[model samples]
Target: MISSVYIHIPFCEKICAYCDFCKMFYNEKIVDKYLDELENEVNSLYRGELIKTIYIGGGTPSSLNIKQLERLFEITDKFKRNNFCEFTIECNFSNTTEEKLKLFKEKGINRLSFGLETTSNMQLDFLEREENLENTKETIRLAKKLGFDNINVDLMYALPGEEISDLNKDLEFINSLDIEHVSCYSLIIEEHTKLGINNIENIDSDLDYKMYQTICGFMKDNGFNHYEISNYSKEGYESRHNLVYWNNEEYYGFGLGASAYINNRRVSNTRSISHYLKGSYLLEEEILEKDDLVYYEIMLNLRKSSGIDLEKLYLLYKVRLEYNELVNKGLLVLDNNNLYIPEDKWYISNEIIIRLLEGIVYE
Candidate 1:
């Protein structure tokens, strides 16, 4: 059964140089038309399934004006989401205003995620982004003032020319906040981004690894649980919306270039705004075989610190792989009947997951 929905907003005031997500500069003339079609897409695809979470992610959800946001919320209301546990909306600092945030709260959005890539103005300028640091701080303060306690801050490390000292500065700043959750990621230069076009080099591998480990240590020391590969939260503050993705659950996605998985089939909308606005986005469905599903589940679930539910694996695949020995060897740790890599091994999770998947495939 589908339990989550992802709504993508593909318009941004300006495209950040490091951003590779499908996005276009905002045009007032096209927004209304685009939103009309987006509502159509959502209404047509919703199956009246109970939604546990709804995540509005994207180019920048806060870029929409109050009227546009209201229209979008009206579309979401068509879904049967009475039991929704969390409704998250991703916002960029430059565009998120107190009034805009108030609209989200009125629409029942309980969780807010701010993409504060770094607290350093130097790094912001280096990336050609004009986001104001004070604005970000004020926005978070406003969210808290407006009675939002479930908040997530996004941090990025290992950017080109980043050093350990730079990362520690960010860590120190974040630790001073009342944030309930954080998602820190290493900077990856994807093709088509300006960073990729400029041939920007990555930080040294050893230094990058050290930075990652330092972040994990700092977050744990601050009493946050490293729940997922890139996420840490205070107790009971884990991202319910994101867990749906890691669990390989089906969801609906509405917007240009958005992807959805439903009934074992994964579908993607056309990346073109003109194409999506004209109702030509239903031509991107792909089905997965049993092996594809197995590979996907293993790769995604291993991203969680609690690892996979071994009992669920046996029920779904009817095959069991012994993990007690891996636990004994100290590479894997068992807790609550699940296996996870030790905290020290989080940076090498890809290697650990690959070995487990290889064994599962051979068996």
Candidate 2:
């Protein structure tokens, strides 16, 4: 049973320079049409199964007006949620108001992911993003007053000119909040983004690695567990929706540019809004063979600090890995049944995962 659902809202009031996600300028006419198509897609695919987690991610979901958001919520009313269900929505400080947030609380949205890429005004300007830290504090305080506790704040580090001090300030600001989660990412210069177009150079690899280590150490010192790559949370607050992806479990993804994993096939919706509205939703689907599935399980599960269960992998996929070689090379560790990369080696996890997959295939 698919217990998770991810909804994508592809409209943003202000497009950041570094973002390459499927997004567009917010238009009321287009939003209304998009929501209508979104409803259709969900209704067609959803089996009315009880969902344990539902995440509405963005292009700034808070960019939508309260009424539009309400309409969106009304559509989701068809899905049944139990007491343990975690319903989260992404928000931006500029558009998230007390009234809008109050409406969300009433509608059963128990969690919020605020996109505050950086607290420094200089970085904000460089990224073509706006952040009012005071306003953010006020909004989060209001959420706490309204009995909402689970929250995730996104932070970006390792910009073209980012320094360790700048990152410390961001971390300090995050510590000030009563939020439960943090997802910090290094700036990636993706093609077609304003940053990329402007020929922004990434920070030195050594410096970038230092910044990553600094953030990890600071977050850990502040009592947050580095539960997964790029994510830290107070115990028991790890994002269930994101875990659905990291666990390599099947899920329903609805709306433009959303991807779903169902029936061992990975499917992504069309990125074009016009095509989506015209009922051409799916862009591509990949049917995973047995080898592909096992590789994915290793790739995704190893992202967590807890790592993968080797015994369970053999039972589920009947594939044995040459993890012993990885252990000999200090690239991986096998503690009885669990195969995990040491925290120090996690920075090179992408390279390590590729090598491990190659080595395991030879087994």
Model 1: number of clashes? 0
Tens-place lDDT per residue, model 2, 1-363, is: 898999999999888999999999999999999999999998889997899999999788999998899999998787899989999999999889999989999999999999999998888888988567779889999889998999999999898887899889889999999689999999999878998898888889999999999998999899999989899999999999899888889999999999999999999999999899998999999999988899889999999888999888888877788777789999898888998988888999999999889866423
How large an RMSD does model 1 have? 1.7
- The TM-score values for the models, in the order shown, are 0.95, 0.98
lDDT of 1: 0.85
Give the whole-model CA lDDT for all candidates, comma-separated.
0.85, 0.90
lDDT, model 2, position 278: 96
> What tens digits encode model 1's per-residue C-alpha lDDT throughout 30-135?
8889889988888788888888899998888888888999988998888777744699999988988889988988999999998888877889887776477888
Candidate 2 segments whose C-alpha is farther than 4 A from its true place? 361-363
Q: Judged by lDDT against the true structure, how good is candidate 2? A: 0.90
Off by over 4 Å in 1: 322-329, 361-363
